[model samples]
Target: MQTIQALNQGAEAVDGEGEARVGDGTKVWLHWRATAVRNSEGKIDYFIAMFEDTAARHDVEVAAEANLELMQRLSALKTEFLQSVSHEFKTALIGIQGFSEFMRDADQLDLNDARAFASDIHRDAERLDRMVTEMIALDHIESTRANLRLSAVDINAVIEHEVAVTKISAASAIVTNLELKLPKVSGDEDKLSEVVRTLLADAVKYSPDGGRITVSTSVADGTVTVSVKDQGVAARADFDNRLFGRDELYASNPIRKVVGTGLGLGIVRQVIEMHGGRLWVDRVDGEGSEFHFTLQAVDASLVTPGGGRVA
Candidate 1:
């Protein structure tokens, strides 16, 4: 029998009978009773005996903790709403002030410095736009807004449309490698395009100077890999665990220093997941990062293929 000392969630509490050891992901409640005992030298010490088999109590606590988590998420959502609203108001005010000042002192202001200030205002406004859009997107996903509008749209054409809309003139060079395919995806065309477009836009924002990003789509292992690969730092070795997160932006963009509110991926993830697909970030070792979202290639065996339900 293992000597009595202490036990916690991370460590195993060996059963005195050698039957089992507490393992990871085990739902357990731990309680200890302290009793005074005399040592051989007549000194007093506390002997703690742990009690187990409190499943009902543990379930009650788990439910309470889950409710607390829900409250916390709701609180966080409220905070995000307040901050986003304030940011939008501030951005509008700054734009008005900046453009008004630029117009009033057009002759005296140095053009370069004025342009930099203008850029800051522009970036903030864009940031606010992305934030608002993501909030709406998350809501829509949660609601599972019904739109099964399916069409025979060319998947390749949609990629091109997104690329033309989000052209980046940064030091990084955007190279697209989207190959053609057959039996177009039997799903909503507009929503799928948004997923690819947003992912590419993000990759461009985090790439290095003269960095290259390639967009590719192909069928492999009965799954389609719609990927946006950037020749910049992919996932930070330190923070790869939280890839589908925005608050981890500083970790992702360490050197080139791209500015982001860290909410885009959360939205992107929601959209991708709503479509009954897998979304993930893969690091390219010596290269950059590639975001590969997977979807069922086609429904050839099902013939009709109209029962597309979101899981």
Candidate 2:
């Protein structure tokens, strides 16, 4: 019909491209051209239409476009990561330098003043060390080079210890709902403690208004699940998937404030995954966020009488 219309409009040929489904319901890209087969009288006698399947070429073009987009996204993420790292390092260095200079320039520093200056320097140094450590840890885990000293870990004990440490300076109220006598899991105690600490710290950081932060643990189906729930700025669902990504420090939401180098959660994820566990986050009753991770619980039947694994 289009060819006939074009011919009646005094066109000798017409061509276009579109999509169509073949007999097997397979979608295909098609390019069609119609030419007027005219007699000597210069009037169109019949139309010769040709169709070419361009599915392969179309697929290649689509793939190339997608690859280009992915490259651009990665380049942008790299730029963001470098900028964040530099800013964090500079802030820490400035504090350390200022405190050191104050101590060095004081004509007659009292014992108390010297001690306070030393403390500030130490704190800033620790912050710098932590950032570097997280970067190294993340790289090791991602490269499958992290050496986990796996053993039967008492998760409850680990959680209690971390909670006590967090309460030392946490502004938010810390709460625990740990299940007693939960089965021990096979993991690195220190790394698991780090995970708990990271989550608790995040909970405290996000809940700037001072709300309840709950740390809970439970066991089911040979798996031990640990979760940290916070009544803070609730992250939108669209940002959930990117929460654990290395490039994402905080959501783009204006209400969600960015802090640190944003490597904590990424490190937490790598550590958990390296220990053969899975990590994820969820919305807390439509008000806040909850971070969860699962570890493989040791089988009770496989334990010896002396609290050791059976060979």
Candidate 3:
């Protein structure tokens, strides 16, 4: 049975009934309640507190812990599968690259035909490599094995590098605004790279030929900011919560159009959190989506001449 009151004064909330919820953060104390009592004079006398029914809270906590354990196990299994897939694909890619190179050297097809075929092969190989790299990166971030060696990297430089690696040309006019003085943010380079890489990828994916993706960075007050804004249609008004969190083979909703494993954004969240940062997906006019993340910029003393902070 739960105790209704305590006979002693100076009773702590710990010696009470009912939970005391701490503020905006997360922390709960159970079996705690606080009350006050007065004497015959109606003046303040003492307080009464009781502690009871901790078993229910304990059961809930245990269930939550069990669920966490299950999720970790599932994540580990998925990591292994991704690694295996990457390895197999790598071997296949080598064979295909060899054949393509040989065919290019032989000059069997007309100039136009050869060029087109070679370009296709190159694109496919690059895509495969990107996929493998992303998978391994997600594995590292999820496992907390990512190094936090924060650097003051140039936002523009990073964008240029990733674009070069992906061979994505600035075909659209909107792809032009990647230059901005972002606060010399200090965070793990690998993790930050994953964030921007995913955002740019999604932007490129949803963007049509005429579409423009505005990648902007700005520093304000003391907070550093980075944003990937796409001209693609924002998410539907009816979209519930599947913006970047679906692991199933198909889209979870009827209005879903894109093909994805929903793993990218979730991994983004993990990476940001690991760096003590925050990430969010905002639906612009409920017609398109933009992804953003923020990290605390390191001090000037931590920065080098190139803007990347020293490890």
Can you rank all candidates by lDDT, best first? 2, 1, 3
Q: Write the per-residue lDDT of candidate 1 for residues 180-228, one digit (tens) a residue.
A: 4433555578778877777877777777666777776776666666788
Kindly list the per-residue Cα lDDT of model 3 for residues 1-311, writing each as its tens digit. 22233333333332444455556775455675556576776544765655565767776787667556545744764665466556556655775787587775884667786777677676667656656665776666545533467777555566555655533454433443432444466676766776788777766666555566766665666666677776665655454343254223223433334433345666676666555567776776634566777777665432222323211
Question: Residue-wise lDDT of candidate 2 within 1-311, one digit each (tens)?
Answer: 77688887889889988899999998889988889888898888888889999888887787667555544544454455567778878988999999899888889999998999898788778778877886676555544423579899888778877888898898778888777658889999888898999898888877755678888888889998999988766655665555354224354534454446666786686567667688888875446788899999986633212221111
TM-score of each: 0.55, 0.55, 0.50
What does each candidate score in C-alpha RMSD?
12.4, 11.8, 9.7
Ranking by TM-score: 2, 1, 3
Error of 2 at 151 (Å): 0.7
Query: Stretches of candidate 2 above 4 Å error?
Result: 1-80, 83-130, 139-146, 243-258, 284-286, 301-311
Report clash pairs, candidate 2.
none
Q: Could you tell me which residue pairs clash in candidate 1?
A: 246-262
- Which lDDT values do the candidates have, in the order given? 0.60, 0.75, 0.58
Q: Which is better, 2 or 3, measured by TM-score?
A: 2
- Global lDDT for candidate 3? 0.58
For every model shown, the clashing-pair count is 1, 0, 15
